[model samples]
Target: MTTASTARRPRGRSPLHGGRFGLLAVLPFIAFMLLFAVYPLTQVVRMALSHVEIQNGAFIWDFGTLANFARMFDDALAMSSAVTTAVFIAATVPLTLVLGTLLAVLVDRSALFGPIARNIALWPAVVAPVVVSLIWLLILSPTVGVLNRVLIDVGLPPQGWLGSEAGAMLSIILVDVWHWTPVVFLLVYTALKGIDDQLLEAARVDGATERQIFWRIVLPLLAPALAAAALIRLVMGVKAFDEMYLLTRGGPGDATTLVSLHIRNVFFDRLELGYGAAFSLAVVLFVIVVLLVSVVVRRTVRQGGAAA
Candidate 1:
């Protein structure tokens, strides 16, 4: 009787916990991440800290010191590339915020054009980065470009848009702004739409101006969304490569030479794999600094709004 009752006892464990097939089903995804993401990251860290040397026609890896990083610091062009990258980030992020938030405000206020304008705004975001770069290159070309033609017709100089140093950097930043404004517009507009209508109504009852309501209530609520957008832009800025490569090729005498291109030049052009890895790690460190700054700024803005 005791054995029969024990055999009939209810089992509380789910199939996922007890079944081999459940764990097996997710094993492939785990393996995929390990193979692609974890393995590459491990290799990068390993390469970043070591010194590679060729002896007797065989490659030898010595992993103990930061000699590669010391070389990276001594390199002047690498430092300049870091500065150029910083400038690019500073220019693009704020412009995207202002343009995106303004467009979002307009769309949020309009009933008729809201939906249509919103769809049109996403057109740039949907396009591939490569395609966008190609389109801009054609439009900004020196001799046969439409922009130059327009300028010439209006009796202005046919400037070397991408051939000059200052022009190259400005053009790259402008292109980034054009591509990312829609992204900002969509993000900020969504946040604006999510506001409680009653809050705005209450503000109106208290004799608040539209500008006053926007500065006090609307802006504060939008802080989190704005911060998120800024973070996205910041990361994108760190990873900026294709546009600078495709458009400027890091040319015009280091004018648009971002750190990513600098890394490519080190690894591919110069064939210094160890140094490239160290520089890549430096780029990661720079990204961390940018992230910390963004977080502090966001927290400060939110606190100020709350205090007000």
Candidate 2:
């Protein structure tokens, strides 16, 4: 039966109207994103493919090829830098999550200082990563650094912070935690705010302790937000470059070199633009995979909870 006419729309407004409105609303954002983000990204990729040959005291792009990737494999410093970057991400991601959660919980509980405390917590995130790195570099400097001076005054031995290979990655991690933890805290705190007070009241009335309510009710509800925060941090952590560069320039022995830094060095320093582009694309693909896996894990957790 041809029921196309009978299945008539009950809409008061045309479908195209809504789409038009949406398009209008999003046009500025799309234009801005394209101009600032996409255009630059495309330029980088293009430059990466272009051949860079040293001539007349400047690197000149001759043509494009996969020569950069081939050279990257043989470049020991590049490979080592990539490894160091991965290690930094692994070390910092978990710490960021934990500290973020703790700060979020504290901020949510404050009756008087919530706004003040939240702003303070968010301060580090607002500070430019490069500036933060520079500040820390001074604070952690081996000679005449305030940190070491304080340690000496406290009768503790002063230790080299970003100056040595052994402590450089840790210093970077600390800087990362200081800067990025607020991002997670804000997300988790927002999720916590959306939770129903009635459910918490019910749990309290049911003789559930505070810890029990948090673990059983609050945590499960906030899992998705936590997962999202972790995914974001994971991506950011893996691609960390600005702070690391300012803090250590990959340091005394390639200690804090991350993938982004390696890519920068390949593209700009070594003039292997094509290889750098490939490496950057690899980072993007890795981030996409991580996000996909995180989404799957969150779904799996929801399904398991439902099953139980």
The candidate that achieves the highest lDDT relative to the unseen native structure: 1
Worst 10 residues of 1 by lDDT: 10-19
Give the Cα-based TM-score of candidate 1 against the true structure. Answer: 0.88
TM-score list, all predictions: 0.88, 0.82
Q: lDDT by residue for model 1 over 117-182, one digit each (tens)?
A: 989988998899999999999889997888999999999989999999999999999999999899
RMSD of each: 3.3, 4.8
The per-model lDDT (C-alpha) reads 0.90, 0.83
List of clashing residue pairs for candidate 2: 48-273, 48-274, 51-63
Give the residue spans of candidate 1 off by over 4 A: 1-14, 17-29, 53-59, 289-308
Clashes of 2: 3
Per-residue alpha-carbon lDDT of model 2 for 80-141, expressed as tens digits?
97688778878788898889998998899898999999889988999987789778877898
